[model samples]
Target: MSIMRRFSFNHATAKFWDQREAVEACARTGSGIGLWREPVQEMGLEASAKLVKDAGVQVTSLCRAGFFTDPTQAAIDDNRKAIDEAAELGAPTLVLVSGGIPEGGTIDSAREGVKEALSVLAPYAGERGVTLSIEPLHPMFASDRCVVTTINEALDLAAPFPAGQVGVVVDTYHIWWDPQVWQGIARAGREGRIASFQFADWVTPLPAGVLTGRGQLGDGCVDFKRYLAEVDATGFTGPIEVELFNDALWARPGAEVFEETRAAFARVLE
Candidate 1:
């Protein structure tokens, strides 16, 4: 028998392509997809949802939620809307990139804000049958993108929630360099917290904004087969998503990018 697995292409990987076309391509390739919020909103959530559904494409996750570092009511409200959006689209996971340091405070305070925000949002996500996947961005993004910068940190933050309610996203680009990555993966599996598993190889001399330097699947140093094995050992059977943020990819036609990414992802897995 074959080692059955599912692959998902995140919308960010198709930033160069039109959103609908991206989803269509993933569907045609018999893979799943992860949606981004802005494009979904711009295309109209209901319409986008219908498009994916009609294409017979599974939505592994919705790109984001939980930027509530300030822990303000507005932040909470926005997250709630995000949860609703995820639920509306039948996405099982809502990837959360915890907001960075606030203007007036320190990283510790921002973390505390994350705790408060999650405390408020977790129950709602749980009730709606959506998993909130807390993503630990790379340390390079520590100050502005996400304060949660390691799998361990993400797991610690998720420790308080129910297993199926809140979880951590394991994105190779962000956590690959960590010394305790294996331990973190083990812990997350033991706790049933690996909600989304994403791939984006690393590239040195990271770009200025540090957002567009993602390497293609097999072109970078990531040992994808090993990563997949670790995830498999955890008994987490969710789709493995490719989420590259490279500018070159965005300059190509969505179909070409999607095909190339899918091929690379499959090649590395083999």
Candidate 2:
């Protein structure tokens, strides 16, 4: 497939962009979208689903569900709800950020929590036709965002489940620095576990918030073309979602953000 044909704009890239407008823009561009739960809820599940469906926009994946570091019944329940939401929206994958170390818990213990939670939810997700995609954030986020810090670790967590039930997301912003990223991608492909693939550049001197540190395509050190070739070599031809977060970008108009992001993506990959 053509690169632009596989392009997807994640709503969080322009944090405050109106959902309908974003989806419409994606439709016009023949792109896909990665949707978040809050905006979907605010837009009402039915309405949000209709908006994408009417526009003929593909819902690439749901932003998140996990945070099951403790694996409490409540956490499991909430993730189940997220899975349901993903099903309703026709999202094939539900990205999971295993929450940080819980109170009185160590990182290792938190990882155990993720394993147990997946055992419970993976089957449910499989039954509903949604893949629970484990996302290993940069180690800086290990304590509070996700205990899984490497693609290998995430793969280990997903090992027990069928590829259709659980998989890993390869988000460049998070895993680009991993020494074994290429191996992990090849392994994921061999196992059919590449549930979702996302792009975001890693600019140096991260912002104070850290979370808003993602750079626009071509603005940083990440090699987007190389990443594309790596995944393509894995025989995966899925949508490549551009998910960047910048406070300044968020502060601007959404339509402008779309144009800038579009140009930036082409510059970086084409």
TM-score of each: 0.97, 0.98
Candidate 2: stretches off by over 4 Å: none
lDDT for model 2 = 0.93
Model 1 is weakest, by summed lDDT over 10 consecutive residues, at 1-10
Candidate 2 structure quality by residue, lDDT tens digits, 1-270: 456888899999888999999999999989899999999999999999999999999999999788999999999999999999999999999999999999999988999999999999999999999999999899999999899998889999999999999999999999999999999999998989999999999998878878998999988899988999999999999998999888989999999998898888888887
lDDT of candidate 1 over 73-114, digit per residue (tens): 988998999999999999999999999999997999999999
Q: What TM-score should be assigned to candidate 1?
A: 0.97
How much lDDT does each candidate structure score? 0.89, 0.93
Check candidate 1 and list the clashing pairs: none
